[model samples]
Target: MTLTLRQPSMLTGMDIPSATQPTPEPAIHVRGLEKSYKDLRVLRGVDLDVARGSIVALLGSNGAGKTTMVRILATLLRADAGTARVNSLDVATRAADVRASISLTGQFAAVDEILTGRENLVLIARLRHLKDPGGIADDLLARFSLTEAGGRRVGTYSGGMRRRLDIAMSLIGNPPVVFLDEPTTGLDPQARLEVWQAVRELAAGGTTVLLTTQYLDEAEQLADRIAILHEGRIVVDGTLGELRRLLPPATVEYVEKQPTLEDVFLTLVGAGTEQGQR
Candidate 1:
């Protein structure tokens, strides 16, 4: 199948806001967030906000406090001095409520390798106390394109498939906010693209996502807003176009353009998929 990637025009089923209407509060809000390991400070008064139904990418290098920030926001870790709110509920004062509103996917797939893909999803659904776990599993399998391999052991699946299944399992109760902490860290190119598409679908379905990544291109491809964290603080935050404006405008040139490796890879992969279908 040919995959087309584009940002969603608006949130699913929401009408455009009228000019006179009050602005909606951000899905995530953080201010003066601070964390320390004895004398080693990890986060120093970092401030950030993520709009509802939008994807905000936290871009940082190794040891730049990206994971620290995510953990604080997800209610897995507490901040030393600051406030974080998810869906307008304070993550500190309402940790349980915050947990109920969000799902956290870590750097690695958290699937049970011995279990089949369907089994894993069903297990999560049952744990969440949802009705018809089998139906829930089937629906997510199809949603993430894992229907044919649903019966196969997760150990037999590829990296991308496992990650997709992990994400599908996280959507058991349709949590409005998702925290993806480097979800595509080690996947191959095609697998990375697969995860990217899955993330896009989340935003399209009105789920707010806060993605932490070291991949600059991943932010460009998926984030509605990009925030660069350096030395435990957000130094810059804006749309891709707005970030581009920070550099001097390009001079006019007549150099011939060439397709990037990504373009060539996707073209070949798409052609191969089409041939297989035929």
Candidate 2:
């Protein structure tokens, strides 16, 4: 199957105000964000800003506190120090309001295996007190391309399909800000691409997305800006092009032609075909 990669063009044709220029308010803002557990500190004086209608990828190794940061921003955990705001509401003081403006999909898929795909979405819509839960569920099912399997139990769905449904459930309330924690961790290449397309669509539709992923290529392809967290702090934050400048210049070299295993395999197959023709 052919896959057409989606480029990040959400910023195209838009006038990007300079850093010195006054700009619109950020969708997410954090300053001196600190979190600690007993003797160990998970986050130490972290600061970040995610613009509205853009995708920001937080890249870090395991245990670098990426999940911890997402939890705090999603109002699922409290910060030992510093402050975080989502949609301009304080995550600490206005936890309820912050939660109302954002949806969080954790590292694992949160779906009822026994329930049908449609049923899972409808349950969430009803929990959110939507007036037309069935209508909302149908719409999301269509959006995620799961309408054909809507009536099937989630246990019958593939890994990619289940992740898609999990993301659809997160959008039940139409929150402006969404947090995705290692969304495509264990997915195969094709499954990863499917999720990447979904994320691109989300950003194109003016939803602010903060995604945490260990996959460097995923970050390069999807994020308008990339932030690397190290040792419980942000070591660098910029666009892919800007980050590339930090590395040494590439050295171009030419090598003599040599027979590779692929070439040998193709040659053997061709020889067998010719001999059979005789």
Candidate 3:
């Protein structure tokens, strides 16, 4: 399905020029994007456009080239054919500029277990050459609700805390775009909700997010738009309602309401805070 959208607009409360003016450029733009490995084609003429400050979920089954497409867009891997641009900068010719405009978090958390959570953020901030690395670290620690555990060694941090820290590090430079590849993988339900809130806050703050996930519910919960990758291409791309319309009419049936497994799980787990506090 072709994904068509109106000209991108700045999110509410964003400190930008008046919308009555010209529309801002798309955060991500791809046309006829393709990739391959050793005679095996992974992507075949994929076309996509992600608006500024919106969350777009890329969903697909295993070996569907979701990760491959993400890697190419993140500048970690080059596409074999087609073109991609981030913030209007070409990924192939302006790789550095593209990198400067985006941050990427892979499927697993990437944090230094040997150091304190605070130290890890400070280290990344310093590497980014920020004027106030300590201040930035402190703010991010508080933003992610890690301030209470910031001083503890990362080795002692829970999986949820580590994932939060990893995401915090990615936001050090406040890149306009972020790529999250299965960020909630292996996370408990509570931890997953924490990450989901973080992602929501990012988009609310005018950051464009492109995420890939295997979870359908996750896509429904977090995505403003959803694109399904299949057979080396985006077979379906649209809003959830739009995509649902593509399906055959459902056979409506009235039955007694029953609690789902998720309901039971959430009941047992309790409604933990977004910080993953039990």
Candidate 4:
């Protein structure tokens, strides 16, 4: 929240030429990823590939390893075994380089309340060693629609505004990939839409984004691809249309009056038992 690079940033390394031949590799590549605490295994041989210029949403119920996966990708935690690459940079050994290419916004708006919105962005820009700190701050503020509130302390901001500032702070260095963990957790309906719009714009600009959330509707709205995680493992991964095809079509209630309980169940449960919440 203070934007101090709290520990040494795991994100520093070589910059490949833009004109270099593009590999078939994805922006994120995870193979046999495992994490254990004593005898309790939280992640078990998880594997995934996220393409560049896309948004991949991780969906799951409570107790799933979604947050754990996010932490590892963000370089906040180490896997007991397995490999992860961010922009082809290894998450463990090339941590600094990997971090450099990735930006992460955690579930909560972890802003420094004492700092002004402009100060928050400047802090991150400085921590990332970007030139022209003031200019960088100004640019992020304007881009996130926080320009008018730039000078105000984050503590004075509404939930939506604070989240915007928090996300803006993460982008000061213009990382190519971003990991957002349950970004809409605490926002009101309107604030959620604003964040969704921001996420869409980020992906539209060719930034690879990985988002983890419990909200199915959010995933359907924003993810170019969706992967369902359950009990620390990825259960399914594919495009929304693919999943929908595999799943029974959901029934709709188009109406003038309140639907009956049976109608609600039928609409929500769909025709197949396989179509589920997680």
Please name the candidate that would achieve the greatest TM-score relative to the true structure: 3
For candidate 1, what is the TM-score? 0.88
Tens-digit lDDT string for candidate 4 (196-260)? 88788777666789999999999999999999988778889999999988977888978789787
Error of model 4, residue 165, in angstroms: 0.7
Better of 3 and 4 by lDDT: 3
The local distance difference test score of model 4 is 0.80
TM-score of every candidate relative to the true structure: 0.88, 0.83, 0.90, 0.83
Candidate 2, residues 1-278: lDDT per residue as tens digits? 11111212221212232345256568889999999989889899999999877999999999999999999999889999998888888999989878877899999989999999999998998887777888888887877778888998989888878898899888776677899999999975556767888898887776789999999989999999999999999999999999999999878889888997746755665422111111
Clashing pairs in 2: none
Question: Which pairs clash inside model 3?
Answer: none
Regions more than 4 Å wrong, model 4: 1-22, 249-278
Find the candidate with the highest lDDT and give its number.
Answer: 3
Give one digit per residue, the lDDT tens place, for model 1 in 33-78: 9999899899999999998789999999999999989888888898
The window of 10 residues in a row where model 3 has the poorest summed lDDT is 1-10
- Of 1 and 4, the candidate ranking higher by lDDT: 1
Residue 213 in candidate 1, Cα distance off native in Å: 0.8
In candidate 1, stretches whose alpha carbon ends up further than 4 angstroms from where it belongs are 1-21, 269-278
